[model samples]
Target: MASSNWISGIVVCTLIASCLFVVAGIIGIVLGPHILQSQVEKQLPLTADSDQLDSWSTPPVPIYLQFWLWECVNVGEVLRGAKPYVVQRGPFTYLEHRTKTGVYFNDNYTVTYRQPISYTFVPEKSALPETTRITMVNTPIVTIVALLRNQSAKTQEIFNIVKNFFNETLFIDHTAREWIWGYEDPLLKAAKSLPIIKDLVPDDHFGYFYGSNATDDGLYTVFTGEDHINQLNNINKWNGISSLPYWRTPWGNQINGTDGSWFPPLIGKDLQSIRLYLYSTDICRSLYAKFEKHSSVLDIPTELFSIPAEIFLNSTLNPDNIAFGTTDSGVLDVSVCRQGAPIYISLPHLLYAADRYQSRLEGIEPDAPIHRTIFEVEPHTGLVLSAQKRLQINVFLQPEHFIDDFKYISEVVLPAIWINESTTIDQKSADDLNNQVLRFFTIVRWVSIVLIPIGIVIFIVTIVLFKKHRSREESTPLLFAEANNTIASDHDH
Candidate 1:
């Protein structure tokens, strides 16, 4: 009787435990995503007030800039009938201060924020000299002066007249120049005193000019005006009901989505292509950027690792050769992006352009992966954990029929230099995000997987044990009655 009672108690305990496990498993599977989403939503910056939004926002992140300068070592060689060559120089590092200035809601109730960005070169952190000179070899005015230096006095006078005409038409004097990174060579320097060239080049101070504090001078500045984010608020139609702007989806969050939405609250396995219209300080324009449809979903490690270069290459950010104004069939007019100069934008390693843009030049390794920009993003929070923003500055050089020396030069876009601005998440932030968020999800996933199977096994075992115990209990009474009857018959005999 005691053994039977103990068995009955064990079965009851097992059955109750099994039911609880099964219930927990089902709850996790069905409601886990909703619960997690709720937690994320609570942390979102939905309030219009700056202080409230700032409380939930991420702090300013540092961007480290490194410039790979290509020094024209063979300029003298070119003068001696040899093809010009360049040697790659230091990765000059600069610390860029980036921050979201403030948040406010527009008349349409769209949340908008200002990002104030500034940078200063850190000489101590760099591998190159603070003041290095690069010859302005490709500038039309400089090249024209060099070509006419040996001509007769009459030829030079005629060239001067032609140079002045071209300068006014091309806005050559007003063309943006980076004095910090480039300067005119001695040959071009002597020609600066010529009558036609006296007022062509702006004062040295003008070379350091950036636009008003909030804006940079370029064609794309129009896209990044005070009301930039408003342009991205595109209405999404769904099932005859207009949903909120594509940025704010049924998920109640903004994420890097299609052309209309370029921020993040990305969730699930939808590997759709996202478009971004970002203003480039270098190119001075707002570029139409898009990622390739097939992006690699990486399994990010807790520790820092090199990001794949293929990610940026596959993105359709770089303009195709057809983007240049070509008479060829099926060519697109990308002239709006050109600001008096042929603008060629590229990824860190010069990965995307056709033969016209010479990326595989000297100082660039044949297979150096470090030349490519790297990016590590926390998908859940939409935070950039680490990034290397690499871009090469290029100029499309075309021959001028008037200049004698230009006949020998092939029309191609020449790469001047590339810049890599890299940043990594500080240790403290990495630890907090990884330990608190990522690990929690991992633990919950594993626990749910384990509990369901264990619960089912325990429930089955409990049922089997209960059946055996009941059978034994039912047979006990029958056996006792049979024995009693046999004994009674013996007594009668």
Candidate 2:
């Protein structure tokens, strides 16, 4: 009896433990996603008290800026109305630094800030030294002449007189550093002496990114995510304007997107669930990206999102751009926002561009694989792992009948320089993500899947043990009773 009682007690305890395990497994399976979601929710909001504050104020990753300038090889042929030929020059790489300054938290669940940006030349990364000479079309002069299409003939004549006096050619020569940074030009100064040209351009010197370094682009107001998590990092206002007046349509002017550095959490996993928009102060418009393919970086799975080539296509192929009539494919006329300089933006070498652009120029090649902009994002954390932004600048050149040297050339776009901005997540941050977020998530998922089978197996074993003990007890009942009667008779005697 004592032995039976010990066995029965052990079986009962085992049965109870099995039941508890089964219940725990079920609970874990049911609540696993919610728990993971909750963990992500705590980190999504952009607040001063939040864990991302330091990184937000100053990006932890290194950003690089590279310029591939167009050097005209056949200026003589181009001037004589032959197909304009150009060759690509150096990839002048610079380490770009950014820091948020003049930050202010607003009461309306928004934060306003100005980002001070600077760039330092990285000699090791560049293809050529800063001293390499680049000869290309005089963009500023051409731009001014283009703008004078509607000006009085006297104004055009005045511009021509100045152009002649300065001995400015259809193309100008400058060193790589002067082309990328700033170089003084007498034409820029002499043009101001003309009454009509006085207010045309405020810049006295010209470069691809002149006045870009050590400057704040604009004031940005972004949501804090305290009120709505999806709105996190979305622009609320820029420079006190709700929308831009640059474009012709309301949709084009609408300023709704993140500032390219941050994105809303939890949506990176779903390609169709949401679209990502980036509002670039430089471009003065919001551009969207579509999920392209599954990819990985730093040994982690990621989603590759790329801006479609159609985004740069002009009026004919892209209906959204129809307001600007019959423009070249892969042309985005941001000239209205860029000091009315007839500057157009495009992909490097006009990839996905119409054939006309390529036919008009020599020594230009469009490689689809090399020039597309992409963002590799880790899905679960909704963090960007690597961002590569590429864009080319072109000047809208037309025959100015009123001005000499410009009259012989047909209307075309002169390729200037393409820029690439790249950045990747640091190793330390990737490690923290694995340790703090992914590891816990993986554990919960595995535990939920594992415990169910373990609990069921133990439960079945306990049931078998219980039946066997019951059968043994029933079979031995008569023997046990007889022994009890004998003991009672002895006591009576």
Candidate 3:
């Protein structure tokens, strides 16, 4: 009985408190507009491009899809006034999966007799051409290359970088040098043998080398289209091709777009440096205290897919902390140090200048990340870090067979790649922060609104009960007084 009575008392008090809260909340609701207005009126810049870095382009190019497994750091889709960039063609668009070969060359033939052709092309194949062409309309894709060169000095360090370029992982080497692997006939003896074709190579060199087929006696020329002349002409404009001799393969005549001659670009020179913008990729393993599979923010992976110098050293950071600060001054710059060992650094602003040169050659518009980050780097550095490091941007272009270059185009080919790319935006730390703040305020406002009405009802009930009890008590007193007065009058008579 005592417990029940205590519970009843608690319930009554809670109801009364709730009623008061509801009333207060009703008043707060009326002031909500003012609060909302204040927040809305606060100004925020959409795109920070006051101090913009100009970009470069190369022209007459055969379009090869670049697949960037980017872990976006900021709200690219929102700021660009559209949905985030995705691989529309989906996953595996750039993976060439081939099952059959019309013919293959045999090395068993004697000097007087030419090599016999076999029915199969050797090496493990990825995505086949017909398969990729079928799904070409579904995903967003970009062409990517494995950068393999030293842009700093013309020393054996270049060979070390080249040998390790596509080793077990990908890393950005800033020493300036020409480099390439998987050339058709005249294979490089070492990374040192790469030709110095271009005169204006950047101190911090950047380029990419990629091939679809792999083999011993030089891989077959896997050309995909008949526009070889146009593709060849376009590559020449970028000044990124090889000066090595070309050898004709019997299979070259059999290739669908057979020109019977192949000239691949110097590994670093055949690529557009502007295309080396930093993108977030899934880390094979976490190295930092904050890094985890579930964590949102991710640093560039030097051990995964190859990232060029233009993208690596493209931002500025606070001196005390190497965190990216502002790109307004120039391309964001960074000193890549592991346990205090400085590896390589780049100035995206300088790359942006190089981008301008390349853009003039290519007709395609530069992507959003390219224009925004590179442009912001200049202003941020110009005002604060005047004595900052500056790196040059070099362009590398390779004349990949139409089908060969297209393998990396995740946009038109891979659905899985597209899904992964799409999911990258929601996983960013900034998005997580914004979402958490929004949820907290939303819950608070809703709970306060709900309590206001209950508080008002309790307050009303308490006032009514008190007034009724007081009125009844006063009536009894009045009745007693009247009766006493009547008795007194009778006695006097």
lDDT of each: 0.47, 0.83, 0.26
In candidate 2, the residue pairs with backbone N, CA or C atoms under 3 Å apart (3 or more residues apart, or in different chains) clash, namely none
- Model 2: number of backbone collisions: 0
In candidate 2, what are the lDDT values of residues 75-159, reduced to their tens digit? Answer: 7777778777889997999998899988899999999999989999999999999899889889778868867778899989988
Error of 1 at 19 (Å): 4.1
- Which model scores highest in TM-score? 2
Ranking by TM-score: 2, 1, 3
Query: What TM-score, to 2 decimals, does candidate 3 have?
Result: 0.28
What is the Å distance of residue 477 in model 1 from its true position? 1.8
lDDT of 3 by residue, 85-167 (tens): 32222112222122222222223210011111111221232132212222111010011122222243343344344434534
Off by over 4 Å in 2: 1-13, 267-270, 323-326, 464-493
Please estimate how well model 3 matches the true structure, expressed as its whole-model Cα lDDT.
0.26
Deviation from native of the Cα of residue 275 in model 3, angstroms: 24
Alpha carbon lDDT of residue 180, candidate 1?
34
